[model samples]
Target: MLIEQILKTKGGDVTIIKADHTLAEAARILDEARIGAVVAMNGDQLAGVLSERDILRQVARHGAYALQMTVENSMTRGVITATPQETIDQCLGRMTDRRIRHLPVLRDGRLAGIISIGDLVKWKIEEHKAEADAMAEYIKGG
Candidate 1:
């Protein structure tokens, strides 16, 4: 399935945080939203992404001081993004290769939505089930 189709089902609402925002603020947003990552923005431009892992790493390295750091300092820059036209399998491969769990989806060079490794895995399982059902029905001559 295409990334666009997934977005259509999931809706393209991405939680964003400013680059200048503190990591503590980003953590609050993530906690309140029950999400794994947030897109860091710089005046409407995509700056990078900040995830739970990034925050945890910072905390491990600098203790409580990490929370005071700017989102830009904790975020993963030069992010590897996915296009709406890409297939789930393609995106999954890229994520696996990069060892990333989240991918920001872009449309026309603008942030559209985000996809998680869990989402792709769920769809893959659903697709397999659908195919198995179809084959079973075919065998039953229905």
Candidate 2:
């Protein structure tokens, strides 16, 4: 399945935060949204990505006060992006190779959507099940 298809299913609305937003505010947004990451936007531009991992990393290294720092300070800049045309398998491989759990999807130079490793895994599992079911039905004659 294509990433675009997944986005269509998952709803591509992206949650965004400003680069200047404090880590505390970022955490609040993440928690409130029940999401793992948020796109850090610099006005209309994609600045970076601030994930739970990023916050934890900073707090671990700098203690709780890290929350006072700007999201840009802890965010993973120059984020690796996935295009809408890529296959789930391809994106899965890239995410695995990079040891990342979340990926932002960019298409037509715009912020499209975000994909989590969980999403890819779920879609893959669903695809496998459908394939198995189809084979079973074929064996039964049809």
Candidate 3:
């Protein structure tokens, strides 16, 4: 299935934060939203992406002081993005190659939605189960 299909099932709401926001604030947003990452936006422009991994990396290097730092400092600038038309396999490949857990979907030069590795894996498992069930039915029918 394509990314658009996934978005349709997963909902198109995207969690975003400003570049100037502090890591502490970002952490709170992530925790409260129960999301893995937040898109950093500078007005209508996409600036970067701040993920839980990025926050952890900063904490490892800078301790508690990292929380006081700006999200822009820890965010992955020039983030890799995906289009709605892209296939799940293609997106999975990109995520694996980049060692990233999240990918923001862009359409018409605007942020559309975000997809996580969890979402891809869930879809794959469901597809597999459906195929297995179909095979069983076919065997019984024959």
- Model 1, position 117, has a per-residue lDDT of 97
lDDT of 2 by residue, 13-117 (tens): 999999999999999999999999999998767899999999999999999999999998889988999999999999999999999988999998788999999
Off by more than 4 A, model 2: none
Candidate 1, 50-106: lDDT as tens digits: 999999999999999999999999899999999999999999999999999999999
> TM-score of predicted model 3?
0.97
lDDT of 3 by residue, 1-142 (tens): 8999999989889999999999999999999999999999999898999999999999999999999999989999989999999999999999999999999999998999999999999998988899999999999999
Stretches of model 1 off by over 4 angstroms after superposition: none
Q: After TM-score superposition, what is the CA distance of residue 83 in candidate 1 from its true location, in Å? A: 0.6
Distance (Å) between predicted and true CA of 25, model 2? 0.4
lDDT of each: 0.95, 0.93, 0.95
**Pairs of colliding residues, candidate 2:** none
